[model samples]
Target: MNWYLKVLKQYADFKGRARRKEYWMFTLFNIIFSGIAISLDNATGLAQMGVGPIYGLYALALLIPELAVAVRRLHDVGKKGIMLLVVLIPVIGSLWLLFLLVKDSDPNENAYGANPKLIPV
Candidate 1:
């Protein structure tokens, strides 16, 4: 999907705001790909040997991009990227963070940059 590739292209970029579509699409594709990778590792007997090599490698490669997109998603909601740390608190923290991420973006730009929805993309 274009959204998934877009996130990958940005790679480790942690600046700017990412529209909800971008973040959710990336998450969707990441889940699909991870499933495929795990399936491949299991089919190849890699899981029995150790951590599924394919899944492990795939997860490791996407770690930075995942964080970057999440930070950007938080920015879109007008929250500081540091708010991502709230996920470490407990069940409530994760629920709160989910609430923030799903919350609509600020209609106007804040500190991050112009809203992607408002930009003539």
Candidate 2:
């Protein structure tokens, strides 16, 4: 939860490196929150999603953080952050970026910052 909020706090900040725990924890929280919002509507038997607007805002709020983290993560690999653009290449591009995203961050540091994975969560 702290990781998720920390990412939000650093929203659009592309300069620093983010560790895998921060990135994946934020992703996990985002998915979980969105699921909870949807589940509320389902449980209530309401025709409309009761928390639709809230969840929508949650998504809007996190977009910049997501982009910044991805770019910085690429930087951690000594790769140009713009390489993230390769993710746009349909099936091939998306898979390629997914590979980069899943790979471990460099053991120590690169040009970005300290290894995010090494930080004590």
Candidate 3:
């Protein structure tokens, strides 16, 4: 939960490196919350009325933070943020991006900043 909140605090920040733990934790919380939102929408009959309003609003609110954390995660792996566009290629591209995100951080800092793992909490 701390990791998720940390990412939210960073909000739209697209620079710097994010630890793998931070990225994955945020992703986990997002999935859980999305599920909850969808359930709420369904229970309220919002889904039958139209699009799932709650889910749509939740997704919209997190879009920027999601991109920011992903960019930072790529930075941790020593890739440029633009590498995120690789997801556009096709199935292979998304797999490649997933591989990149799952990769461990560079032992030493590159151009992004000092590794999050090395910094004292």
TM-scores for candidates 1 onward, in order? 0.95, 0.77, 0.96
RMSD of 2: 3.0
Model 2: runs farther than 4 Å from truth?
A: 40-51, 117-121
| Model 3: per-residue Cα lDDT at residue 61 | 99
Q: Per-residue lDDT for 114 in model 2? A: 80
Q: Write the residue-wise lDDT of candidate 3 on 1-121 in tens digits.
A: 9999999999999999999999999999999999999899988888955449899999999999999999999999999999999999999999999999999999997999999999975
Q: By TM-score, is 1 or 2 better? A: 1
**What order do candidates take by TM-score, descending?**
3, 1, 2
Best by TM-score: 3
Q: Write the per-residue lDDT of candidate 2 for residues 45-120, one digit (tens) a residue.
A: 6426365555566668777888887787677666778988997788999998878777777887777778766776
Error of 3 at 43 (Å): 0.3
Error of 3 at 21 (Å): 0.5
- Pairs with steric clashes in candidate 2: 19-116
Superposition TM-score, candidate 2 onto the true structure: 0.77
**Which lDDT values do the candidates have, in the order given?**
0.93, 0.76, 0.95
Report the candidate with higher lDDT, 2 versus 3: 3
